[model samples]
Target: MKRFIAVLVFAVVAFSCSKEKGNMVVKGQIKGLKKGTLYLQKMNDTLLVSVDSVKLFGDDKFLLSDNVESPVMYYLTFDGNTQEKKIMFFGEPGEITINDNVEEFGWKPGISGSKNQEVMDKFNEINQQFKLKRLDFIAKDMEARAKKDTAAMDSLEKEYKKMVRRRFLFTTNFAVANPDTEAAPYIALSELFDANLYLLDTINNSLTSRVKSSDYGMRLQKFIDDVKAQEKK
Candidate 1:
């Protein structure tokens, strides 16, 4: 019968539409979202690519997943755009939960269930203190410059350079401390890329065997090699 053939086609389509059970499962809620698409994205060779997406009609909750071959940074993006709002986190193989409001989506979204993310949080907490000090130095330097105080300006300039070196040393030490986590190499790649070659070498050498094989770890290694090659030329 025609009715039986239609039912068979419907069943086939339904089966094909079933969601995949990827290694990394991301599930969470955007408090004010009612009708929009959410994309789970990551960088693939310098291009941001969306691996999975979901459309919510009336609910604030959503679930998206991707097959993570190695731990890498993943971006929870809104409406397929990363220019304005996106939550970045160190993604690994496991169930991770994210909760945030659309108004302050990228400002301070809560992320959990990834060890690398926790390591990143701790590093950022201390790094923020250094940032605050840098801002204070900038204010004082501007004030000294406005008054045309040459002696004071020179003193502040030397102090600012020292503070910058201190911050770089702190980052190098922190990355060396978390050698077993992917955050270690990620920190080196993001925060200390322009640091002294020796500092980069120290962190790269200190990475754990597993972490050295991670996505960022490999990238860090490549970056160091490229820098060395350029130095020779």
Candidate 2:
């Protein structure tokens, strides 16, 4: 009787642990997607690998669940009859809900339940401002070229370089200010890779120990090492 009781207690504990392992759940709803497919993908080295997928037929709602070892970026790929759309978000271990229209899928959807994704959205808002400024500069440059105005073209070229420099500085500052988050190292590597090596090194050094040990952080460190090796040649 005593042995049976001990074995039963151990089984209960094991079941609880297994349940906790698959704690991340993602539910998505697309208003106009009657028949399509949704894929939940994550980066594996240089490839986007599907971790979960669901087929939709006469319904717009689908569910995906997985065990996330750490907070990382995930992609929701929607395959419709005419076109495909991909939306990215930072995924953590919890329930995340995404709701949007299939017609305007990439235009931004209602994403909630992940704090890291909130931070990413905030960063994207600022990044969009820089993108608009670049577009304006290009328009002005085109006008100068059409007029054959050499002096104006030179001036606009200088201004365009300055704008590019400002964007790099903004990325550097964002990484430095958000050193505790995984996004910091990610932005440092992805956005500021072409910046000065010293600047990149500074951002890497400023990262918190937790961020430095993250998946993106390790990638950033490897990028810097590769840059150093190329400089030696």
Candidate 3:
């Protein structure tokens, strides 16, 4: 009888322990950011951590998963900000926490106490490719226009827009898919259009808004003044 009771007690503890460990899913959208890469990191002790990143899709949704331990805290970082969420293994699965505000960087799910380093390097290489293509288009267009070659100029313009659209799609997709992150990558792609006149008409409105809006325009003017003032002083 003593041995049987001990067996039953051990079985109960084993079952409870098994139930306490399970998978957790995190989902959220990045607002006001059109393109960028979002990173999910698992904290390791002593300034070490394992990191993973997801590309943001056009719809601005992101998902991350981990096998959680009870009372564990993980961080959701986007752009340059980080938010904490305390994971409770006792609750139902599929719980969600959304980090929406980009300024204060508030968290929807509370009861979190924490804290990663490192950025995604793959996206950087792709961005370099985009810059090279953009420059090539600009130089070709300039030479064609200078020679009075209307047909070649027109062709270059069309090709430039097409290249821009492809970059937009890549950035938009990554931004939407990882809404919990920033749109820095997508914003960088916007700079490519500075040399391509043909892009102003064909590119997405969001990309154009960044270049032409009073928000950016006023800031740009202020920047120029600040630079000039510094030069004099």
Candidate 4:
């Protein structure tokens, strides 16, 4: 009985130690991004499981580690935006690296979003729909411009503006509903800016402007500032 008890104790300790060894290290680089936020999420049907979040370094380097099981679909996001480009991984318990261009991935300043698997699918659909419509109008307008058909160009411009307003409304609602989603805030804020631009263009278009020049601008700038600060640690 004594020997059996000792064996059981040893087995328990070994199990715990083995579990520790499974700590996964998720590391990556974001090019063209000075400072930004990132999140690691577990995919779910109704909502995403927020496993971890990190701010990227000045050089856009980041690292996250946790004891996750094998064959997990882990997602990486920037600035909590569900629409931000993401890095996907399928590793057991080790180091993984992603080197991506943030700008090319659609990570623009003042927008919030992610690029996770499910989120990406939805994003692509929304964007494709928007793109097709916009492109059709743009092509028509370009042809009109070449022929100096000011009337057609003017009509197309009005159509484009109307489409923008509709798209903004759709985006705002989607972002509001998915507030917890990283992409939600970005889309919502972007729509807000577009809506406000007609009145705020002069002040907003200034090149050397500080972020605190406006409400949404300040909030987003602060968010970026906070994330970058964390990366230093």
User: Each candidate's TM vs. the true structure?
Assistant: 0.91, 0.85, 0.31, 0.39
Cα displacement (angstroms), candidate 3, residue 33, comes to 36
Assess each prediction's global lDDT (C-alpha) against the native. 0.91, 0.85, 0.48, 0.56
Task: Encode model 3's per-residue lDDT on 58-144: one tens digit a residue.
Answer: 655666555644223245565544344222111113454454644434433232111100112334447678889999998998899
Per-residue CA lDDT of candidate 1, range 1-233, in tens? 99999999999998968867799999999999888999999999989999998888999899888898899999998784558688999889999999999888888989999999999999999999999999998899899999999999999999989988999999999989999999999999898888899999999999998989988889999999999999999
Winner of 1 and 3 under lDDT: 1
Worst 10 residues of 4 by lDDT: 108-117
Count clashing pairs, candidate 3.
Answer: 16
Query: Tens-digit lDDT track for model 2 on 67-167?
Result: 78767899888764233567788888899999888888767899999877887788889999999999998898899899999999999989889989988
Give candidate 4's TM-score: 0.39
Superposition error at 94 for model 1 (Å): 0.7
Q: In terms of TM-score, how similar is model 3 to the real structure?
A: 0.31
- Writing each residue's lDDT as its tens digit, candidate 4 over 63-93 gives 6666754334566677745554665543335
Report lDDT (Cα) of residue 195, candidate 1: 87
Model 1 C-alpha lDDT versus the unseen true structure = 0.91
Off by over 4 Å in 1: 1-5, 8-18, 80-82
